[model samples]
Target: MTRSVYVTGIGRSDGRQVVELGVMELLTRQVDRVGVFRPLVHDEPDELYDLLRSRYRLTQPASSVFGMGYEEAAALQAEQGTDELISRLVDRYHQVSDAYEAVLVLGTDFADTGLPAELALNARLANEFGAAVLPVVAARDQAPEAVVAEVRNAHDAYASLGADLIAMVANRVADPEAAAAVRGLAERLPEPVFVLPEEPALAAPTVAQVKEATAAKILLGDHAGLSRDVRNLVFGGAHLPVFLPALTEGCLVVTPGDRSDLLIGALAAHSAGSPAIAGVLLTLDERPDDQTLALAARLAPGTPVLVVPEGSMPTADALLSLEGKLTAATPRKAEIALGLFETHVDAAQLSAQLSVERSERVTPMMFEHELVERSRAARRHIVLPEGTEERVLRAAEVLLRRNICDLTLLGDPAVIRKRAAELSIGLDLPAGDETPADPLSGPGGATARIVDPQTSPLRERFAEVYAALRAHKGVTYELAHDVVSDVSYFGTLMVNEGLADGMVSGAVHSTAATVRPAFEIIRTRPDASIVSSVFFMCLADRVLVYGDCAVVPDPGAEQLADIAIQSATTAARFGVEPRVAMLSYSTGTSGSGADVDKVRRATELVRERRPDLLTEGPIQYDAAVEPSVAATKLPGSAVAGQATVLVFPDLNTGNNTYKAVQRSAGAIAVGPVLQGLRKPVNDLSRGALVQDIVNTVAITAVQAQDAFPHGSGG
Candidate 1:
């Protein structure tokens, strides 16, 4: 039978979706194909189901995800009895279960179901479906003893109905002590209970929600900005000096559109990072002039400026009724929800209950998931020299929100802040002592360390160090001082001086400009002869490492061998098994040329040095990756067809191959991750996207973890 878990809530507003999402994440991590089945859903579009489909990259058709709408189920139960209703639902459930290794069954909501005994109905369905039941109880606004009693009662109710109870959860507990007390009380029960405290951000209204409630026109802002949470509401009617102090981070400002003074003042405060406002709500149906709108756009480019048809009082009333939801559009909330669930829930116990096994094949989603989780496990500080770039700043926001790594952004601090404000991204700036605040504190608490190389106190120290390191190579204090002012040089120095664990640069800069500083300051590792780079080409089914793709132009035989070794080591360092393939225009002894000879020599050197490595060489591209071609050319070679690490003969072949595969094959190229460095410093392409920056930074952090296993310089 397919393994399954049924998530049911005891009452409404229990925040059970968190548990559902969390369980789905665990299921996907363990199995390649996990299906979702909602026994009963509303007639409208299901936000949670859409979120699951998009986030998990589920291939199942939407029509198959749910058994039936609530109205249809209600009518069937009223006319044909509950057993007939359940029998049809069970058939629908089996449709999903038959296709997937595991299935997640979302129980019907208790609100307006018109059922006389909803909880009993859920228990019966779970038992019929052969699914282990995990019940969620809303503990919000309840006393500690009451919360404990509710959990016990829910467990008893499910168990008495012959449902296989796996675990229980107490969600939305307002009082921390009460949450703790409930957790303690849960031990005496039949199963484990996970208690999650109230998170205001999850319940706060999103900008999009506000727009929907008030019928507001979106004057400015992109989808990203519209998804921001409105944690608080502020009415703006006073003068600039008086209203500025009232601003709070993630608050929506309510004022008339004619009050450009208040609007501009709020934007200025957001720019200064006093408190990052969520958006502006223009009341009374007033609209800003074109010139004013243009100014607002420049001041806060993506910040939502909304115009409503009602006055401030009515707008406030509408906002009060709005609540944030976990939807496809609000991915940030999903991250926050997942983080909360992972932090509090006992994943080990849950996995054991579900009997989930680890997946053998690593998909692209799995690769990205592992990278983020591993980087978070061994935290490291990574510096970015292109801090003022919009994509970099946006990627920084994602990194900070995900709690992936500590970041030090090198540029003019003012410029970085201004750019972040314009982008409407909340950055956690360093405190007075140059240390990041606790990332989990709240908005603006996970800021990156912003450093201006020109004004920083470490400039003199870095200049002196640079001068000492290069004194014999025509360096002086004046030249070192001038060079240290450059963000790339300063960032590289930060890595060399143990201030940062690693550095990722080259966005909006050339590769030479980015890595030149690293070569000058950080240099290559003592055990390695040369520096090379690799791109983790994330194909549809697996991740392949491509090396010498961005650096080492026209490398000789020795350099080629070093590249192969570095690429293999990198492949193993990541989760990929090292099966090296040295590529040329020839396969086996089929061709003769300088290029083929170089590759043949490199393969020989690899065999001589690392006899334990699995390697094949002097191979064409077709023979390296295609199993049919490999069987025809070299049938018995272990690494011929299943090559995980491909080493190009030179830059021309390596770079072109990577790009062609990336564009034509729709692959996600995660690097140009530089290897063999004394410290980890990776370069990015100038056209890298936000996700590209995020992936490179994560790779850099993982490299740092490998470099300093004892948590050095984090």
Candidate 2:
């Protein structure tokens, strides 16, 4: 996607320089198409554009998605009709958009204060063509809130007219705190926040941010979260001077321990107010000695301290995790520290993972539980908890009245009504017929005849078998026998046919009771292997993916390999790069036997199968980390340790292991988020937390998007 902005008047040359520089930086990061447009240029096309075009070999005539060749654009003024002028601008926008993924419509400086009208036209055009509009607000030393307010007003105006504003890019941010405050203020607004830190383009931390994001807290001192303008410095043993000056405020420093001079220089620069001191983290694993402590005390006093035992913390593999991230915020500060931590989190790493723009693709499918949300338009049976509390019953009542889902209860309708009335909780399930029917057949009605075995769609699909069954004189009875093994038999039938998209049961049944019918009838996806589960491990920095907690037995090396690959693929779909580690009781080559061998062999197989994947195996939790240990054991393996996606050899290890990690390590498990399904189908724990329900729905939607990439989830 590419966006090009047009400008007729920059208050001054410096203003023009700032505007062009900021615009180019933001656009280059976000889009592939970069061009400029000026419909009625009274003067030379902005000098900055010329400089950029000349420097970058960009084409000229300044043709943009909105074609405003200076000659014809100048005639628009002499043209009598306003509608005609607007129509031409709109047509040009369409032409430009066709050639690009997106177009940034820049308003012109119509000398007669026609800038607003031009902007309105641009907004209308953007709305018509579905372009993301991000108004660029240029300011210098202004109140943070004022800049935010102006951008928000413009955003609201566009949104009110049926357009979505992606974000606002502030030009010439001078104060670090004010810029941070501006970002903070804008996030509170309905729109997303994108801040351009004040720094030279050559010194931006784009690469470092990418590394931080991909590594998922593997590296420290990458504070791209606070500053958009962070540039890496090329240095050897002695170029600390150049590096120190270029270190903008809030920039993260990632240097080797042997490069003590650079570290000291960074600390000295921060001491001198060169920029904001985000945090300083040592990358090596050797415990801090007197010298290291002294240096850290002098340079990073009170700053959050983190040590990544990943030996040398510069690898291309670690940087790929940032493939789709839009901002310079490092994964540590943005996602891990701030996004994960509700309050004050580790400041040292917060810059790397500070929350920024997430994936923009909207999911096409709803969760199994969310089916009730569509009840208003269709008649359906929804299963609720058998012994639901008053609050839950009341909520169900509201849902029923709103047509969210057709209410279905397993208990007697009369008893349910009496209870609901007694507790002041209303419900519609109580009004339905309470009479029990035959298990094999459905509700008695004309619909029953439509479900005849010979004339049914199932008959056509299973014709030979049906004929043979008829010959046997009792085969249909046998097929119908498996229909209702429990009280929720009718609900299972909805899932069998496509009458209902899915069913949510198990609030009152055991896991076996809830899943047996599904396994017998609904069945597993055709391509799926053994069913498996993964918990949505919500950690401080990013979400952790744990698997096989609910299914699978002692998976062989191949099964383990498949689990790793499937988990990694799922993580990628969710915008997370997988660093898979096939965990065993042993670390390195210390232990032998089927278990360790399985991990070792599986790790190799995963690498061979998916050359693009990052993985390691037979690694102890500590050795996979603790850089000192990793360096000693696996001298030079790419994914020697510090793995993110942990694949256990069997369900026993996967289940028990994740539970221990949660209880002992204080990690919150968001799922047993099921994986390897054809659709976004998830099984709920009997005692599910409310947040779990919400997250499952979100995951279901995400999976639905994956299942139906073309928006055909329904």
TM-score for each candidate, following the candidate numbering: 0.92, 0.40
Q: Which stretches in model 2 have alpha-carbon errors above 4 Å?
A: 1-482, 485-493, 503-505, 625-632, 635-641, 709-714
List, residue by residue over 1-714, the lDDT tens digit for candidate 2: 343343222222113233333344334333344455433344433543454554333443455523454445536645655556657766766666566532334445434433335556556656554555555555556777766665566666666776556555455567776677767776577655555443233223343343444342422232322223233322223477666666654444555445666666766665554543444434554345567657755664443333445554353234322222222222211211111111112222221222223223211111211322222223333343342443334434333333333333444444555444333232323233442121112111101101222223443343343334344555454565443323444444434543333444444466566555455445666755656667756443345567667777888878778888888876666545577777788877789998788889988988899989988778876665456777877767566545556677888877887778777875556556556654334555666643344344345445544454543212
lDDT of 1 at 393: 81
Give one digit per residue, the lDDT tens place, for model 1 in 115-229: 7799999999999999999999999899988998898888888899999998889999998788888879876886888898787868987889888888999999888788777
Question: Which ten contiguous residues of candidate 2 have the minimum total lDDT?
Answer: 441-450
Cα RMSDs of all predictions? Answer: 3.0, 24.5
Q: lDDT for model 2, on a 0 to 1 scale?
A: 0.48
